[model samples]
Target: MISSYSEYKSYLEQDRIALGVRNDHFSSKIKDFLFPNYIWRFEQTLRKLEYYYNCKNSFWSKPTYYYLKYKFRKISIKLGFSIPINVFGPGLAIVHYGTIVVNTNARIGKNCRIHACTNIGASGGTSHAPQIGDNVYIAPGAKIYGKINVANNCAIGANAVVNKSFEETGILIAGNPAKKIKEIDIKKIIKHI
Candidate 1:
């Protein structure tokens, strides 16, 4: 939720830091553009759209909001991402440009480093979805669903299918049904965040 410009900027900066990007203005504008990271661009449009949506009374807010919304949709489609606005907190890092579909009702906390081919969605055609905690790392090809709650500083192993709640923090969960593999230091998994 970006209610103000300062908070929006802070969220964007945190997202950049989570993505291991240089925070300098020149680096953000010149370096990122020259390379063209679609994931980063999607995050930027997402943040800007959220900001404009919150502050809708500005003279240029409506047009800017529509433009950002269009751009966001385009990038999301290209990257195969179906993430909704305000679902993820600050410090969101997408690992790759691939299939990463999230349920609209899912609420993920801060510093979530999610890889591609991951799906955080609802089950049984219901709206109930996983509520993930902060500093969580979702590895590639992970499928987490249901109305489960994952604790903070957790790591979901690659290709893991999580269906139950892992309430204990600082642990690694994996497998088809998803079991707690072991207690781990999340910092080792996500060094930048």
Candidate 2:
């Protein structure tokens, strides 16, 4: 949980590092911070920051909390990412901004890169959401639903609807109710990313 200002700063730095912006000099960092695709991630971080600020019992908390919530809501509408503050891990990358959504109960791991039009959400009578793993890549229009567990280093191809668990790591899953397409070596590919 992002319960402090230090935690918020760390998450921002983690996002920058995941995006390969290690240096983060003033101009470059600010440019990339507001870059269209990347802005959703920053907004998500802001939501978490707002959550922490609201937890404090100070006189200043009200104004700050409301301001951050207003900003978060405004940006969320613009970006179309309906995800909550708690679900994503530190190094999330929203590669594109169009129509992406995640259930608040969903838990995504670190360094996951999700593209446009993806949905990580609930399904059927189940009250739970998908649990995605570290360094996973979700392509455009992919849908991961229910209490499914997607293991680390896996990739969900475009338009795949994942409904069940794939506990085995390092494979490609794609289909209507997604199945393992083939074994994949994400470590080699992630080096370039």
In terms of TM-score, the best-performing candidate is 1
Every model's TM-score = 0.94, 0.84
lDDT of all predictions, in order shown?
Answer: 0.91, 0.77
Error of 2 at 74 (Å): 0.5
Q: How close to the true structure is residue 61 of candidate 1, measured as C-alpha lDDT?
A: 68
Worst 10 residues of 2 by lDDT: 36-45
Candidate 2 accuracy as lDDT: 0.77
Cα error of candidate 1 at position 86, Å: 0.5
Give the backbone clash total of model 2.
Answer: 0
lDDT string, candidate 1, 1-193, tens digits? 8889899999999999898877577767787778887788899898888888886767866777788888889889989999989899999999888999999899999999999999999999999999999999999999999999999999999999999999999999999989998999999988876
RMSD of each: 1.7, 2.9
